[model samples]
Every structure is written in structure tokens, then in C-alpha cells.
Target: MALDRTKDSGNNSSQATGNWKPIGCEEKRAAVHVEMERVNKLPANSSYATHRLRVLNKVLHLISIQRTASQNEELELLFAGISL
Candidate 1:
């Protein structure tokens, strides 16, 4: 009953066999980390995977916005001479 996550096969098709637990947020994040580590193994022009990454990035951005205030003042002071 023990699963070796370090040696996980990375075959998501196995999920349909009902042998896996429901993935929570932390597990989802870990899965993303594993996939990112193997990015070079992926084929090019995978729109589905690209879309998933974009959605994940947006979710992380929203979470950051929720957790912290904008450092607008510091940014303005640092770029005081730069014209936007």
C-alpha cells in the first residue's frame, strides 16, 4: 500500500484505474513541479499543456495579490527617472 512518489511513472493515464487518491492543492503543486523538471522531455507545440501552465500562473498571481499589498511606492522611487 505504499507508493514511491520519487519513482512515480508520470503516466497520468493510470489515474482512470481508480488506484489513485484525489489530488489536493499541495499534491497538484507537487505534480506541476515534477512536470516542470521534465519539461525538456515534452514534445513541442503542446497547446493543452501550455494553456494549463498559463492557468496555473494566473492562479499563482491571484494568490500573491491576495497575500500581499503592491510595493508601488518603492517601485516608483526606484524608477523615478524612467518614463513609462
Candidate 2:
């Protein structure tokens, strides 16, 4: 049944990834390809990724501020004014 599914997908999709174990050269090549793809797709100080990190940081900072604010109303207002 699963073999039929494999054959069906292979027939349909452009890239067919079935359960196949590579032995020597092919395995090494696949590993290299996967590694290269990961490296290439990884962002290096890009705007969108940085934006996401900044958002996460702001959330954590807000959480910290909220925890530490207490009844210090002036400090709470100051922190709240600095929006992300």
C-alpha cells in the first residue's frame, strides 16, 4: 500500500522523495547538497529576520519590564512609551 503511494507520488510530483538509502558517493553528494542548501537559505543580518528577532526581543523586554514594574508607575509609563 505504501509502495503504491510512493509510485503514485513519483508519478505526480516533480521532486519525488521516497524512502531510499544511499550507499557511498550518492549519500555524500546528498549530504553536501542538503548542507549547502541550509547554508544558502540561512539569513545573515537580513531585514526580515532582524525584524523578527527585534520583535522577539521586544516581547521579552516587555515581559521583563512588566515583571519588574511593580507599583513604579512613572517607570511603567516610560517603558510603555518606548514602542516597538
CA shift at 29, candidate 2, in angstroms? 39
User: Candidate 2 lDDT (Cα, whole model)?
Assistant: 0.45
Best by TM-score: 1
Please write out the lDDT profile of model 2 over residues 1-84, one tens digit for every residue.
255444555345433554443244344335444544444465866775555445444434544453554534443443344332
Clashing pairs in 1: none
Ten residues in sequence with the least summed lDDT for candidate 1: 75-84
- Give the whole-model CA lDDT for all candidates, comma-separated: 0.47, 0.45
TM accuracy, model 2: 0.29
How much is the lDDT of residue 38 in candidate 2? 49
Off by over 4 Å in 2: 1-41, 67-84
The residue-by-residue lDDT of candidate 1 on 1-84, one tens digit each, is 976555556686466355765444455456545654454355658875665456445443443343334443333332232211
